[model samples]
Target: MSRRILRGFSRDEFVSCRERAGFPSRADLARAADISVGAVYAWETGSATPQVDTLLKVAAVMGVSISDLVVVAENDRHLGDLRVFAGLTQPQLAKAVGMSTTALGALERAEVARLRPDVAAKLAEALDRTVGEIEAAYERTRKRPPGVAS
Candidate 1:
């Protein structure tokens, strides 16, 4: 049998989470992720999807598993949410995980296809979360179902 593609979250959920967390603007997320405010809008409005590398960086900042941002069944994922939960600035998270801000941004944006094992391990340690959690969250986002695609 073929595995069904799971859907993710909706844009409203992303916005709601941010608002509830007291981060009411894309600029806030941009600052945290070290990305342009336009990029934050794109991610929030479904204009663009972040690269995997960028996704991880965002996750680190938000203090969540990449899966937490994913709206499974809706196909919507919010790396920004993860970043907010992690509560780390891009530079701080990058330093903790032993990567340059540029490299971290690449990961958060999913521009890089895969993370080096060592780096991933270090990220897991610094985030005070397990490597398995990070990997599992990444795995859940492999397929984009309808309604959640960016």
Candidate 2:
């Protein structure tokens, strides 16, 4: 799949965001995120990747949107990126939108270029994003150039 395995996580941005959020050190940030210092170190050094739920908590503790800690601009983020940032698994988001997991996965992978407006609406509501944002993200994912990260 062409999906971005790391979802654009930026170690520098994460460290900067933590500092900006008033966490002076990795230990402080780790305490706030309820994770270990080693985990924070791993993230900072790009040696580990955060799961969706863990990233969500870190984002919350840092007082920054997930996009702020990622290389991708918020508007440039694709369907899967948005979904992952929103901490929803394909199965969970699929059930919430009344679609099969396989279908949702296809959409997330940008294999399905067009999504129904009703399904988009459901996604918007479920992901706590605007419908316009949903549609734009879908378009970006579908039209992303070959070998380009989404």
Residues 1-150, candidate 1, lDDT per residue (tens digit)? 111121243456656655665667888877887978886687788876655456557655666555666554322333322333354555777788777887776665454677567866876776665676555444433333445422
**Can you give the TM-score per candidate against the true fold?**
0.43, 0.76
**Candidate 2: lDDT of 141?**
90
Residue-level lDDT tens digits of model 2 in 1-150: 222366788989888999999999999989978999998999899898776667778899988887777667777889888788777667778899999888887887678758889989999999999999999999999998998865
| Lowest lDDT 10-residue stretch of candidate 1 | 1-10
> Among these predicted structures, which one has the highest TM-score?
2
Backbone clashes in model 1? 34
